[model samples]
Target: MKWFKKYHLELLLVLPMTFYILGFTLLPLIRTIILGFQNRYTGKFSLSTYQALFARPDFLKSISNTFVIALLSLSIQIVIAFIIALVLKQRFHGRSIIRAIVLMPMGIPTIVSGIIALYVFGTSGYFNELLFKLHLITKPINWLTGNFKGLLIIALADMWKVLPTLVLLLLAGLDSISQDIYEAAELDGANSWQSFRFITLPLLKPTITMAVLLRAVDVFRIFELPQVLVGKSVPFVSTFAYEEYDIGDLNGSGAASTILLLMILVFAILWLKFVDRGGSFGNDS
Candidate 1:
């Protein structure tokens, strides 16, 4: 109470944002939880929705595929985005031009990116066409078929679309870090790799945590890339729920949504535990 009185001005500025987040998040979450437990045809509360959802092999496979793609893509996005951020941090001529190119993918509409990916990875598309003409293969390979290939294509497509936003976030973190620490480490005989490992990573942990949280949440609900790329063959959680909802199976959709929410919850819990155990890694001072 005394702290609130002492910092009342700060509290006043923060209260609006606090309320805004609670209003947008808490209410919808309560509604979804309620809907998830009800029957699509009847309003009765029951677990039949979840039972039926789990009974379908295709739905289970979709869940598995969704996890596999999201995990792999998240890993790849972090690594690549980190490397790109590092490169962009370097002093060079035409750096703005290069940064613009790095950011160009995000400017393209997702549907357009999906369409471009379709052609780029299609059987008769440039990938196979180039390979065939070079005598590297016997025939055109279906790059967008089969779960592994499909996931790879989807991951690549998503990387192009989403990587820029993450890269920019990481870049911001990198920019926030002071250069003196690296110079001091260099003076102490630390090489590039050693300095990066000792200084950059520890200081960047918070930004990485924020990036992972946001990416995990968004990727868990991924729809368009898989929808346009593999259609019903590779159903992500979002696509599956969307299909169920479109068919008037509101409860079923809600059940799938609950599962999606659980996945994000589990990820967030585990990640927070890891962060907590690791202690504060981002204190620059």
Candidate 2:
């Protein structure tokens, strides 16, 4: 009671967010858990929905594919963003213009990005036209047909959409580093690479960890890019969940959703552990 009175201003600011989470997140999560355990058709409790979901090899494949794509997409987005941010951190004329250009991707809608990617990667798309005009290939490639290419297209689209956000995050991280540290390194005869290796990367670890965690979760839950690109018939987890829901397999969908929620939880824990380790590393210094 005494602590509450002391922190009352902070509590007042936090209460609205607390209620919002309870109303939307907590309530929906509880409902989903209850619904997943029941037969949607009969409204009776049963485990058959989960059993049926697990019975398929495709379901397993989708789960595996989701992780693979998410990891690859997140890695690519982070690396590209980090490189761009580092380059832009240097003072130069037109630096602001270049930074604004990097952020342009975030302004475009994901659906729009997906559509653009589809058009570009489709059989009769610009890529084929360019390749054929150069006599690189005689026929247009069916880029979306195979396992790897389909995954690549989806990852590419996601990477495109996500790159701007990552760049902004890394830029923010870069800005947080003290310029005095760089000056000290310069005084000690350290080169740009040495300064970055010792000072910038270590300080940016927390921000990079945060960016990776956010991007990983977003990529894991991605639907429209892969779905619009390859369709629901493709074995990706989000598409599979949508397919189940579309076919009125509500219980199965819920169970699959529950599994996804659990997967997210597991990843969340891992990310937290990673962040804690990074924090400890900072503390040790």
Candidate 3:
């Protein structure tokens, strides 16, 4: 009875979370896999759905587009966010105020961010006006009309919305680094770039792994920004899946979703494995 009383609080706290995850998250995932495996109308197991899924040329284009957008945007955002994080870490006047301002985007939802992007990038928007006024162009350039340009606008909007959170994550990792190590490196005649490369990045592997994996997974499944900004004109996997499900092709949607899930899973597994092989998380460079 004493043991029961002691552990009951822990059990009560954990059981609800466990049940919620099982009921809502894991079950849905299993159902999705099963949905993807089933034939469209026959309700029998078959590979025909996936075969048809891959047979479409536009579907292939969407997959390729997703890869290009995800890799390019993530690479650009990480570099920019890390640089901003480094600057924020330096002691300076009004640093807190600057940080708060930079992090303002955290409160802006993706849908709202999409609206903002349209306001700023639309033909009648500030970007076109600025270019026209500066005599950089003869007329308002149609930025979203081109495929690469549309993807660029979407990527920029996503980066703006998510960069603050990434910077904060990197800052936390930066803070966890012992200053004594940097001081020792300075004593060894290391310059700024050398010190960062030798001490900062190596120590930041785990946190980088954490931040990148979280952001990569979320951004790779991007839908709202593209949907709100350009709608079906953009060929993202998420948008394609939405179209499939909208047309009452549940199995087709499931197959697209399964492919996207596998893409993310593979990237996550590779990232984790790479991080693990770089020695223990607690080891400082």
Candidate 4:
């Protein structure tokens, strides 16, 4: 009680966030879990919702595609962002302008990105027109019409939108490092590669882990890009849930959403464990 009294002011600062989380996150979570096992179709309780999900032919494919999209998008975005961050951290002309340009996509809504993608990659769109002018292809390729290619465009849109934020995260990590460390390495006859390997990377592990976890979690809950670009009937889990909802399959939608939530939670736990093992998220320096 005495300890609580001493920290009353500190605790007060977290009150708003606590209520926000409870209202928007915790309450909805409890409602969803309750609804997931209910037979809303008949106003009863059963596991039939989950059974229905598992029975669908494309259900397993949707699960697999969800993971593939998240993994591939995360990997490509991180690698590209890391390289760009490393380059941008160095002194250069118009660096701030370039940084703003990279991050501009993040400022745009995800739905807008999908619309932009539609313009650029839709059949007879600008990309195909350019290709035609350059004698690249006789006809415009349908970039957003098929399963595999549709998924690819969705992933690419996500990659383009997220790359800038990832770059900023990595850059902040780079800036946290002291210049003296690099100079000290130079004095020891260490080259750029050696310095980066021994000093920059090891110190930046925390930031990298944080960025990856954030991106992975974001990718999992994503609906806009995939839904807008690929349509609502495709195998993406979110779109599946949408279809369920459209047909008044409330319980089924809840069940699928619960599944998505579970997936994200599992991944978040694993990521936290990995970060803790590496001591990346700890306050120790």
Q: How close is candidate 1 to the true structure, as a TM-score?
A: 0.86
TM-score of predicted structure 3 = 0.92
Q: What digit string (tens of lDDT, one per residue) describes model 4 on residues 1-285?
A: 999999999899999999999999999988887788998757687998788889987777778778888887888888889999988997999989988888888888889988999899999789899999999999889888767787778888888888888998999999999999999999999999999999988988888888988998888877898778877545777778888889888888888889999889988888778654655655657
lDDT of 1 by residue, 1-285 (tens): 999799999989999999988889887777787888987777899988889999999889988987898798899999999999999999999999999999999899888889999999998898898898899998889998898999999888888898899999999999999999989999999999998898999888888988988898877878889989999888888899999989988788888888888988998788878764443333435
TM per candidate comes to 0.86, 0.87, 0.92, 0.88
lDDT of each: 0.88, 0.84, 0.89, 0.85
TM-score-wise, the better of 1 and 3 is 3
Per-residue alpha-carbon lDDT of model 2 for 1-285, expressed as tens digits?
999999999999999999999999999888877778997678898987777778998898889888888878877788888899888989999999998888888888999999999898999998888899999999899888877888888888898887888888899999989899999999999998999899998888888877877887788888888878888545777778778889888777777778887877788778767555747335655
Question: Model 3: which residue pairs collide?
Answer: none
Pairs clashing within candidate 2 = none
Report clashes for each candidate as comma-separated counts. Answer: 0, 0, 0, 0
Candidates sorted by TM-score, best first: 3, 4, 2, 1
lDDT of 3 by residue, 122-226 (tens): 989989999888999888877777789998998899999999999999999999999999999999999989989989988887887778778889878999998
